[model samples]
Target chain A: MDDDRPLFFHVMAYADDADHDVIDMVSGDPDWEPPTALREGLREFADAPVADYQYPPSEGRGDLRDLLADRHDVPVERLVVTNGGGEANHLAMACGLEAHAGNEVILTDPVYPYYADRAELLGADVTYAPVADDGALDPETVRAVASEETALIVACSPNNPTGAVYGESVKRELTDIAEANDALYVSDEVYEAFDFSGRFHSALAFDSENVAVTNSFSKAMATTGLRVGYAILPDHLVDPVRTRHMLTNVAVTAPGQHAALKALRETPDDYYAETRAMLESRIEHFCEALDAAGAEYIQPQGAFYVLARFDGFPGTLDNTKRLIDEAGVAGMPGDAFGSAREEWLRFALVSPRADEAADRLAAYFS
Target chain B: MDDDRPLFFHVMAYADDADHDVIDMVSGDPDWEPPTALREGLREFADAPVADYQYPPSEGRGDLRDLLADRHDVPVERLVVTNGGGEANHLAMACGLEAHAGNEVILTDPVYPYYADRAELLGADVTYAPVADDGALDPETVRAVASEETALIVACSPNNPTGAVYGESVKRELTDIAEANDALYVSDEVYEAFDFSGRFHSALAFDSENVAVTNSFSKAMATTGLRVGYAILPDHLVDPVRTRHMLTNVAVTAPGQHAALKALRETPDDYYAETRAMLESRIEHFCEALDAAGAEYIQPQGAFYVLARFDGFPGTLDNTKRLIDEAGVAGMPGDAFGSAREEWLRFALVSPRADEAADRLAAYFS
Candidate 1:
């Protein structure tokens, strides 16, 4: 309803320009450094020859694709390297829309704004399937909206804004619905590695012919700015995806791909375990504080965000700004996400100082 | 018309698989290392904090934008860093089409295939104005095609495929026509530093509100894989470009922006001079051999490609494949560029062994 609602990045910038001592619970970016091996790879790439730094094979370098394919247990032909998860999702929608010859894309309400915005930008109509009360999908509701004109249905697991991790049953239903409707399913799994719920099931786990799963190294490797991400598509979609990719971003940055590959190969199992443990601990710490302050919020099952209800102020934007000015903390306004989220504020637990941030907000509410 | 023709990269890969000692004249990638400072900057960035590798300000890093602004003598608000010259051009067209709400985009005949493909991909109609026999733009011819529905006029000077460096008068005429028709002029100057004619001028040099100039460090720094390029937009167009960029690629890779900034700041003047000199020598060597072999070709005024007429074979694809199979050389077919040039083959002089390759061809012809 509020298309003119300012994006969180703009609000963050405005708060930053105000020059207050603000604690950032607003941004999705991790404050932790990437693995040492990944950083080291940058140096190695720098010292390589001109051709190494020149334009890569447009699909991607064979070695990196091989690594990705092996990791995903899919053939290299199914993957196309992209600028980030952003481009991967965009290409999937483009390919899906073309293949189905459809004009409409289906997204979940309280959606990741980028998905809704990009679909519109690409000249496709968007219809939302409202999230269930617990922030999980009800497959029947999604099915009701599907039609011959539906090109794609996008699902995010360990979802943004609300951290509900969709389980195997839900993912299967989504895959089935897409197949029955002749629409493609785009699974945004960039946050898959952050699933606190051990029940997280990949759409790839379904191994369905109509599903395309997109992931990025940003969240897992802590290198969001490097812009290396990819999609593993069904056999039928590869040609169109690769063609669109070649005409769009070409290939992801070479050094970033090199770094991601290094991180993938060398990052110890303990590293993920430890990072997940840290995020889980922070979520608990923040949620406990919210409880103590009598704040209403959903307990996260996966990912690092908490959607806390704060209807005291005029609206989400006003509440978010007031928090920034008064509590010296910044969080994303719910209205910026969707009309349904207007009474909630989404806080990211990406800061190393998450404890202090929670204390400040708790004190303000108390 | 044959959009299905194999790209040179595909042919090159096939040749490599055939295990021939191929002299690669197919790829337009420069065969020189990037500036030492830029590579060294990568190492520095690798050692920086997590914040350095996190998502940058969506448009770009402020420092890089500020530097670009100062270099171009424009305000920081006018620039948007992109994945590469590819994305910059894509965004320029997207912004132009939206602003004019028009369906048609104009490209020159014998055009870079990417522009035509991307325009069509974005759902805009494409019309071509033929380049003069010498490969330069004819102002009157272009003016005749400018209609109310012409949302964009794309010009690539020091042109790809043809290597024509448009002079000041023609560029002025283009800007005037665009302004008179309320159309946008997108000047792609990625090859700006490769101008050998000493007659090159940027559309930005015109200081018109209708012109948006896009450039990249790929050609000059030989860092095409780094995915960093920027566009200088008119003040009014900046918001649209910025919004489109945010929805599309998010931001250029962080390490790349850093590396490019270093290259922009510290590249010695002689690096460009030496590269130009090397290319000039290669062109002379190749053209001289062609003369001896009785081959007819357009002598490149700028850029690295020479469109040589080689109608000896049944078609350009046949000629190209035969050259690879027999002479152990690779090149792009003219049909890959446009139907009018199907009688020609495009050779890139970016190889260090350009002279030897030319000699091999000359001997084969004799």
Candidate 2:
């Protein structure tokens, strides 16, 4: 009963070893290097002498605070640095949801899957509110399922697997519900850079008290293994938890923080901009191929993923394996993303050269 | 309530802002650095020209695996490089306790605080049997609580905050009880290198299906900010929990792993010998001061911390604050560790120079 093995790892499993035609499409990992400015900044980092290796403040590096503060419009003290987007999600759910331990953590159905998986590991009871077949999280649906017993309301904008850019009205509704119930809203905005439709208001903007936004350099800056991310935490919830965070994993890697600080300073704008352009074009190309393949999806407005329905084709693990084994186009079944959409499959549009993915999709369908 | 601070960061926090008369007697962070030989080993890392910055195998780097295997006397596949020992411990428990989730995670009283805190966070009920008043986790106590419903037993040797080193006989006893119940034994040996007594034996030496050993370079190598540690897992448990390790914190830092690979090569043995000698003398000196101060504590056998009882002082947070404010010497209250021996305060022996702490302790008591 390895509950984790089959859970979504990445769209591609053996990507580094994949055959030319295997067409690796996996993870939210962007297949690119840090922006030019960020790389040049790395060279400049050597000058700081101390930048050779120094852990950031347990919460985050100061330069990163400035960048994130500007982007999220949150104060510096609210942030706490983590190893990556993964740790950010792990710690946010662990700390932010502390107000209502043992209560249900509400997650949108067709979730990123980690929200439930991590919440389960952290002892929070998980409840799901269904999104429409279009993959958009409806505010009414969220309201209908929300109760005083809910500990956290976790939703991702430019949602993973679905690519639904949650609207500002929906954001306000969720925030209002959380404010009323005193539950936290953990908005994972790792994909904030690629919001092709630009209304990227933070959940923090909606309400700071019940919101702890988590982001990372993994997607936009292409420094995933450098493993730097942070959560904007409310001040009152910061002390006793500080020791646990320290003792749980100790400080994050020193060089990683140093590199992240360099990246933020060197390419704060261009990193997100170039990645945004790349992601937008990839999403468009993938949507075109899906149309030609007669595959159905909401046509992603943001994020580097699309939930294409193989309504006619099989959506079982066997079908997913067949797609990889036969079509040579890899993807995770939408069924794994949600108990309801087993007939659909989610494809990660994470290719530095996504023209390859588009060609592969065309050839497979033909 | 800021339950998100990484464990073992306290040592660095204290070290960073070291005040006059400030003796950081808290976390088991060693006061040392990578040996000159290991520092030179950095050239090998830089020259090899591998992309160390990218994602490593979810298990770990190959050479590092070989080094860990050589050091721990375990097969390479049994090892997983983690962000730190806290992560290794969390992974060991998550993976080992898979079949026994709801059951009580057996931990000794006056615990490391982290063990109970992390286990509780992971949805396990934590039950404690008292260690000795002097802070040794007796084999007898571990045996008395061995139950079918007990998922895993946490044993810390050269114990944090206590400096209790479990003997060979005790480790064998623990292995026997855990084997009988088919429960896993996760021995956190982060303080492995600080053995003041030469009798340190690893639980990894005890042959059992349910035994996992976790240790870090923090104390032994004195690179807390580096945040590199590894877990030795046998064939049966590695696969189930391996994914969680990847999901929990992704990969350990590259430079830290490079540094740890150097730490693992124990050729001249001067650093370990010197660290042990220094720590041993400091423990002796501090205990003597405690004796003069009419305070009570077990003579520390290993590690860099000791739990001392100030009989008339009523070691509360208030007293701890007063000590920090007036005497400028800081130690941890026993209540922070576990419910047992709240009158006792844990003091770190890892000072920049030995006897500095002893001087502070003496002056404070007088």
Candidate 3:
């Protein structure tokens, strides 16, 4: 179903009209420099006589596949290039779930709407397993929700909204649950590089045949505009994904692909470390500000979001509109993430003005 | 299912060797400069702040859609954003062909392989209707091939491989055939700007419930690597296609979309005139060369491809291999296009080196 977000746009427009100094904390884009290498790569691509300016292989250029494979620690043949992890996840759910028309997808509750929305759009049944009080999935709970009619198990590690990275043991348990039920686990690891507490687990890392991993340059690389990502598919699924991607994009843009290839090849561990450092500091600042203000919240472990429960103002139903009307600061409403709790607001730690944003948010809650 | 490109990798490896001056004429990318306004728009965008780098509206950017709607003489709400026409076609096919196990696709023979391959991959029963002499469809032929079980009729105008733009009467016949048979007509007009003799009829221009149009920038703007195309689909089909596209690509790359918007908005008639002139000139030069070279061929009226038949070689199976090895010139084997006349070779008019290149081919044949 269409997410119907010109609704949010009207909110953004109203927020813009406010004369007060504004802090937009609802934005998902991380406040960080895209790696210098990525910049050079894009510039080089723009200048190159042919940075994939000619036709790329229908499946994708080998350099891209090889890099993706190495990163995933899989065979080069296991990867199929995609427009982004969105497509990767979409393809997996669309193609992998073909065995059953009404197969269930055990989506994490309070989830990235995409997880459930894509499944529904593809005509599959959805079973959202709400996060436990600890902000994590208990394997048994997931197992209870899945069924013989469940064709795919999808998870976002270093989860969106909550930023809870699945621990390895939990992932293994989920893997077993999927295996026992003959279900495919599709894990989105788009935010893997932002594991602030370092306990990131890939569902693919737990199992092979029943798991597919999808990743993208959107968050970690600060290249959301490029729309580059891929699925580390199981061998049998590669051809299907390739056909889908090719039939969809033909290939990603030449310049974007070159930039992606270059970024993947030359990314420094320090770049990720520096980014984590910034987010960690922002998280601490936000947590302290909220704590001082006596606001209820869950501190994010990874990803650049902090979910906090506000008593009277739970951010904005229309992104940033409520904040502009009342708080003078903007945040994503908990309702946006499909959380049962309607009073939670998300503060993006990626905003450069985190301290100012946090203070404004605290002031609003007060 | 993989398009069975058995010798695909071999040709790429051969191209990579750089030891010889191998001419790559097999690629469908025509040689032309992007419209100046498109470039100017990109320059403006490059200078604009990074805000445009954020998410696009699900319906597509309003400005681009407004212009596109104006160009098509359609209403703005009637349009939906797409990654490109490829996806528009795929989603339209998926939506048009309801959920079923054994749906069928009526494919034009020696046609664009993507239609047949994708339909097959999606589990549609792909049946072929032979392209008539001059690469146009006969109403009777389409009427004869359509079955009650058929879902999508994949039609390309100013057709690929064979450069014959289908006429309005033929489209009318095909439309009636699809309507009578309860099938959707998916039209690919990726080469809309290059109707060399000026007869590009959009199926949408006619009575259109079953007709959807797909087009791309690769051929028109000589930006093959940009990988941007879109479709103008029927109203009821909008949400399904939009959801599929958004789910496929979180969105097309911002810059590419920006560039495309600029191209359509800013590009002048002369820019198109020049592009047309270059292709028209190239077609003329090549045709004259082919006549002198004593090769039998279908004279192309539009699109940058000419199908030439070699008498000495009975099929392209040998001619393609021989041309690559002996002449170092590459045009796809006619068999690749599924023409019954296997001796024919499909030469993309992308290379301006036709004069010398034609001589080499003529000499090889002699």
List per-model TM-scores for chain B.
0.96, 0.90, 0.93
Per-chain TM-score of chain B, candidate 1? Answer: 0.96
lDDT of 2 by residue, A1-366 (tens): 223334444435644344646766645555666655544443443333322333345555567677777766777677777878778777778776675533779898787776777777676788888888777778888788888888888888878877788878788888888777778888888877778777666777764577778888777776555677777766655553454456556567665676666666666576578777877888888888877777778777688888877546866666776777766677777666657677887787766556677767766775
Per-residue C-alpha lDDT of model 2 across residues B1-366, encoded as one tens digit per residue: 223233234433554465555555555445555555444444343333224445666667789989888867788888898887878887888777775433778888777776876786666878787887666677878778778888899988877767788888888888887888888889889888878777789988876777899987766665566678889987887875566776567677665576567657643677788877877777788888888788888677887877888768866777776676666677776677777878887787665654766676677787
Instruction: Summarize candidate 1's per-residue lDDT along B236-286 as a digit string, tens digits.
Output: 789888877777677789999998888888889999998898888899899
| Global CA lDDT computed for model 3 | 0.73
Candidate 1, residues A264-301, lDDT tens digits: the string is: 88989888888899999999999988887788887888
Cα lDDT over the full model 2: 0.71
TM-score of chain A of each: 0.96, 0.90, 0.94
If the candidates were sorted by their lDDT against the true structure, best first, what order would they fall in? 1, 3, 2
DockQ of each: 0.70, 0.31, 0.49
- Maximum-DockQ candidate: 1
Top lDDT prediction, candidate number: 1
Error of 3 at B346 (Å): 1.7
- B357: Cα error in model 1, Å: 1.1
Q: For model 2, state the Cα shift of residue A120 in Å.
A: 4.3
